[model samples]
Target: GGDGAEEEQWSQPGNDLSLPAVNQTKGKCCFSLCPGIKIPKVMDFLPNILTINDSSLPQARTRCLENGIGYREKCFYFVEDEAEWNRSETFCRSLGAHLATIDTWQELRFLLRYGGSLHYWIGLRREGSAPWTWFNGSLFNNSFQIRGRGQCAFVNGDGISSDWCSLMKYSVCSHPQTRPTGSRRDPEVWNLT
Candidate 1:
């Protein structure tokens, strides 16, 4: 009673039919479905597996602490104003923290969720190299899925973007001791100007 088109539509990759009738109707067609179709189990478990792997990395927790502005689990708060990339780095360093260097999607997402409205400054900049670079002078290699202007970077609930460092915006900083180890003893607090 079913045609190939119905089978194709029902069995398409990423298509989930929760309805009992649809599932029953499509169950028979699953046999002929393309092998390339992404299984729900794989889709559901892949992120979890990746998250576990990411959390196990030495840099991940440190990066989180940095983004948290020395607060172990508290999300980093941003200033109301902004400054040039160099000044921002100096500001963070004065506080014993540095500009945030995001290396994972979870980190980026956390930043975006915490940073509301204000376009915070990140460690990314384009100085000598044609391509952008992080505060440590490393290449900016993350795949930020957004379009924007300027050389400065910020991560919202979505992803990172390029903006002018000189533009006044809030920013997030990290503790220097929390580098690649997520260890922090006493964080130096800076008075923002």
Candidate 2:
């Protein structure tokens, strides 16, 4: 099963995050679960929350161009190289983005049309029987039905489908536009110096 196999990738020997000892750990806080988490200097490049809506489509499109397409409130970038679900997401995170997160039917429609028949790994995935969640740990609103039988999601002419997380496929990476940099809401996790 993908259980330990996929986890091994993140826990390779000497990987800083898996160091067991807290003092030896070097990764940033897991912000997806840390609401109001301030992004550190190293993570400044990561897209901050930008409020986008129906009126912002054109600007969003303009910002996402030359590399990907923008529809609705988010920008979608298609990565041509094939990678497993987790690796694909990690690749996106390195670029200061996450895998494409579909927020509505319109965005989903645009992605399906843009991708046509190609299989592109998206950010949605699940563990065991848990409900689907984006890479950031947000629950999928279940706005659209997803088919197939796996832990990771991909989109094509057939619509969204779940598949083995280990399957290699072209992936989509996306991000929100820029926002002002500042401290996280909590005082415990200080801003990175």
Alpha-carbon lDDT, every model = 0.54, 0.67
Provide backbone clash counts, one per model: 5, 1
Local accuracy of candidate 2 as per-residue lDDT tens digits, 43-125: 44223212222232222222564686666657788999999999999998876778999887888888899998999999999
* Regions more than 4 Å wrong, model 1: 1-77, 176-193
Q: Specify the highest-TM-score model's number.
A: 2
Give the distance in Å from residue 154's predicted Cα in candidate 1 to where it truly belongs: 1.8
Lowest summed lDDT window (length 10), candidate 1: 184-193
TM-score of each: 0.50, 0.59
Q: Candidate 2: global Cα-lDDT? A: 0.67
